[model samples]
Target: MATISSTWRVFLLIILSLCPITLSATVVEDLKNLHPPPHFNSTILSNCLKNPSLRYCSSSPMMDFDEIFKFTIVASHLCNESKNPTCVETFPNVDLKNRPNIAPLYLSFDFFWKYCPLSIMSIDLSNNSMKGGFPTDVLYCTQIQSLDLSINAFSGDLPIQSFSPLTNLTFLNLSYNFFSEIKLSDSQFFKRFNSSSFLHSGALLDEKKFTLKAVILLVGFPILVILVVVCWVWLCFQRPDFLPRKLQRTRRFTPAILKAATAGFSNNNLVGMSDVVHIYKGILRDGTEVKIEMYWDDIPRDSYRRFVEECKVLSRLHHKNLVRVLGWCRSRKFRAIITEWTEEENVEMWLSRSGPSWNHRLKVLKGVVECMRYLQEEWPEVNYELKTNTILLSDYMEPLISRFKVGDQTSNRKKIYRFGVFLLEMIQNKKGQEEFDRSYGEFIKYITTLDPADLHKMIDHRMEVTETNFHQVKQVLSLGFMCIDQSNNERPSLATIFNIIARAYKVSLVLPSTNHRIFHGERFKGHMPVQIK
Candidate 1:
């Protein structure tokens, strides 16, 4: 008897296994019997893509099929290759939440709601950006035990009458939406869920509460904003010391102190002029000589703002080659920047008096290169209209970068080109703007077109020029030519130029001529070969 019972159990297990195969065949046959319309696959695909209600619906069919059965060919193509979250599948739970890009796929099909598959026991469509009146289609889903439509943009009334049919819904979440009110046929339906489920939906609040909030937002917010702005402006103009300091290190000088230092704006004190400011010579009470740059009386409002911004940047910089910005003064009629005085003479004036020795000039060039490196790497936004007269010479003859704008829109490559022009001017002992037919472009053309053999003629005759020193000069000129190249691609980067200069001064680093093209074609008089160690 025990053997017979064991054999019966084994037979039952085999029957259970075969049952699914038989059931699958029947399910497929039943689906095929529906006799889907001609081009049914294409119709379903078109509906999936363009249907207004569920245009961005899931590829899976709206109606759930048996999980164990393979669907018929006609039904298989329904909503296939859909790129949206699955709204309906062969399971009981339907999750179509967090689909912000497009509308829910089930919305594109009326049948999905009207037919309301019995297998769907739960539906979540939260954070989907689905906006409208409460989803009335959910009423047909009689078996649905849970429904979440939170964090959607849904607005309008949540009619209690419409939701009454969802008697089986045990859990309902409708938070973070725009539902304006709940029109109740009875409050009994909502009693099943917590009041927190409808948070931020605007449905739970009474008329008085809503009105109070609306008034506070519409009327109070702007007044508060205005008060804040007024306070900020007052602090800026009337009580700057009360505000938090951004540039703590930078001193603010009074207009009287600046006037006293510059001898009440005397002609002798005025040393130079920029587009918007006058450069002056000044001496502080502590015997500290400073270059005072005062804004022109007719300077525009925007220019004054730019001047302030430039001072802020200049205060942060601390480099030997950079002229130290000492302080600034701003009042009703005066705005000025005070910088540490370097020397009475600039590069142009020093060159006008026959310039320094070759080695000394190289030292100056290296200092300038180092300054450019610091600016490019640390503060690329600070740009200047570089000119020989603006390039100051310190008491020790070190190049001191002065007179630059905070945000000059000139490209770095263009600045390099300008530097090349400055270099040529220094080499020839003549101002570029005054020479070569009084055109900057013509000056560049003349320098770039000069024959290699006659290059010595362009050198400063006052300087002691030997055969070895001449080669070093040629190497430096080659670099200048490279900087002045028309093609930005041909110009060596500042770092590369720095490396070449660093090596040129040291004889051990001077290398043989390589294939590195210094200039393109005959414009450079046969490639002005750049030799590096």
Candidate 2:
């Protein structure tokens, strides 16, 4: 009886030894069954076992395999080409191909919560034809440092709080998505990104604040209307022409009149064609030469309103160096602006004649600076497209700067930077054509290191630089360089620039007072005296 009992104990020990192998095979079979039957791949189960932290890889008994199966399938789909034995160890990097209909295949947050609680660092899914709302699964990746989901078709409102878990996230790109709005209690995290990240997406707002604003606007709209009516009546009584002009109902011109003036919009009368408008040299009924600009018929209503608004502003602006606007015409399919015509060619064409003399170039430069100063300080609008080609020379060789487009109201700093580029182009005798080819910052870096002796190399060869005018030329170059300084704050103001140039030229022009206000209907304090040759 004792021998039989000992044999029974040995048999029990052998059964226990084989139990582990049976359990491992069962776990592997369960993992294989979790995936779709026809689509299930045996390689996925093999990959999961390779993970060092997985229960199947360790000596311990198996735990729940449901989440592990899901994770293995998804990771295998993402990284099928990976050959490393320990590729699934951490699942740190994931860059899946942009396959069609990938949304349904993507695993949900539950899978990530169970399997990938930590260890992910970076995810790049840019330009990956991905669709659906923001994946809540991403929020589970607490240790993730970088996330790129740009150029996707993700739609619906963003779950703003989902990003709160990613405390370690430093770089994020959510551009080119279909998000409707962004609401976040933590604005400090959002301040890390720039406008580019949010551009091409839906409007961004704090939902709580936006709701409050909408309520207020709805409640106070009647009171706002009453206030506007009262102000309109007061302005009407104060000035008779104010209401009519403000409402933009003062003038109307028939399309026939314009067609007659331009000989039925003949090709022979076409003076210039640009992206926005076509310029025609027309003769008015009074035998006055005028330049007419007409917009295409397909322009949007908003663009037409902008054109009219620009005309109103241009009518009020008067400067010696600026082109004068005479009148404007609008019809169902036509919009036009009339300005006094000049006979001389643009600076671009004139420069082709062996370039202008040093004196003429300096004169042109002075005129351009004066015009820029007027636009910057006196005018309410800013000119961003100031270039050498835009400056037209009159019959008397006076510079007339034209071609103004209304844009987002910017500061004078942008104008100053453009003027610096213009000056550089003038000195180089090259059309501003090369401005975009090379990096301007690199050019500035090279120019700043050059000595005064070598500065003449930048001057136009056509212009003779003698000992007499060397200092003046160098001074202008230095001023231009200063305007193009890397730091906008370090650049001199327009007034200071004018003074420097005037002093260098030994001109007797009157300088504006330091405290003078140019915008309050005050005339320009300084005017360039016409040189009498």
Candidate 3:
């Protein structure tokens, strides 16, 4: 019977292999086969994309899948992936009577972003087997009215960046599953809640935020017990000898180098894509290419540390999927890092370009995981943002990340959480706004299967997981979760975390598997369905 089971699994694998080679083709073609929707051309949404401030398309008459996709990709607008928590079988039912009325997977996400990019008020994707977290740049979506993504496999923080845009948010819920540390403070958003708003079932008493072993050690473990006690009292109650020193070093910058790099800040060479910071393309006299960023003053010194740490961290880790970091500089006027130029494109662009092949995606996943294990460390006060959009690429088809710091003081802890969310986006490549309404249904379906490259499939399709190192992919994702646990202690140390990920299935520690079949309740309750299918 055991042999028969193995044989059956093999047989099913052969058939599943032929399920739909449609992973190929433009999203347009992918959709046609998935739902056979009417075909529309790319030219439809060009006008609106050029002027995003105009909210026309959000209320535009509905069109076919292809037309919507073209606009979505062009406008760089957000979209919804799925809304229904319950997986209703639309097949053969009257609800599916109008095939034209039914939206394809890609189109559903596309239109959802267009119509209500910020209209999504409350999102509770708790307890679902959803693989990833908030997409990058979603944190700035101010339209979110409220959100509740507690207790799911969703590792990471409240996505403060997403919260940036969601200033109007009245209630935000992020309680469990690898969300290790949350910083509460006296700010408008910070003062909104108490520690109770963000903890899980068995959290430590009086511990508002979870700290890692390394953090405790770095911050206290190194000192003797007596010293530690004195330090804690001295540092917490009053300033100590360790009070941050004000360093007034002579920061250097070659204005000429920056000018040439950014092409004099030409709109075309406007590399920094957002209003938050200025990005430029710079060329050194030796013809070495660099990307330089400029952030406004008064941000805070902690932000500078994050920038340096990102450079410091990425410099050590080298892998094909991991982006290369050459060097960084800290000037009084500007803090910037220099890296290899990728005139080619980013992973997001590659996803749109060839929709990375499955084999390549698996390779990408492996590279990313390996890189994460080697380079990633938990830094509560370090600088950086770790989200899907931040994961950039080069022209040569390699996956990398943007300079990992955000100018925010919360950037460090947030960056750690960002990586967890990054994994979530790779598993479901939908735009940010669309994810708010659509991620639930898509997540349940995505997680149930034990397919090894289950992760690679959702990444930019230009790559492929054809190589099939199921254990490798599984282990990496498992590690991704360990780094993202709600309790910092639950979230493994970078060394221990990577060690476990390097040998997860083989050697087990306390980290939740994040595997659906195992169903260890690695997360909270709402995401679990009342009746499991």
For model 1, what is the alpha-carbon lDDT of residue 469? 56
Q: Write the per-residue lDDT of candidate 3 for residues 396-473, one digit (tens) a residue.
A: 545565544423455334444555555545544454326446553345344434254233333332222222333344
Residue-level error in angstroms, candidate 1, position 81: 99
Candidate 2 wrong stretches, greater than 4 Å: 1-252, 274-276, 300-302, 382-384, 429-446, 449-453, 506-533
Q: Please give me the total number of clashing residue pairs in predicted model 1.
A: 6
Candidate 2 C-alpha RMSD relative to the actual structure: 29.8
Question: TM-score for model 3?
Answer: 0.34
| lDDT on C-alpha atoms for all candidate structures | 0.65, 0.61, 0.45
Best by lDDT: 1
Tens digits of per-residue lDDT for model 1 on 1-533?
A: 33323322332233234334433343235344433334544544454454323212343555333221222221122222122133223335556666564335455444445544444577777888887788777676777899888998888888777777677888888889998776322488667777777888877766677689799999999999999999887656544544556723246676656777788878898898877778899887668888887885756789777777777877788788888887777887768888898776788788777567666677777788889889888888877656678888887888888866676467877878887877777677354336656577876777666565445446675555444455677778878887888865767888887887777656523433333332222223333333321
Model 2: ten consecutive residues of lowest lDDT: 524-533
Query: Which should have the higher lDDT, number 1 or number 2?
Result: 1
lDDT of 2 by residue, 141-244 (tens): 67789887878888997776677778888888888888887553257656766666676766356467788989889988988999989887765443223345
Model 1 Cα displacement at 349 (Å)? Answer: 1.4
* Index of the highest-TM-score prediction: 1
TM-score pick, better of 1 and 3: 1
Q: Each prediction's TM-score against the native?
A: 0.46, 0.45, 0.34
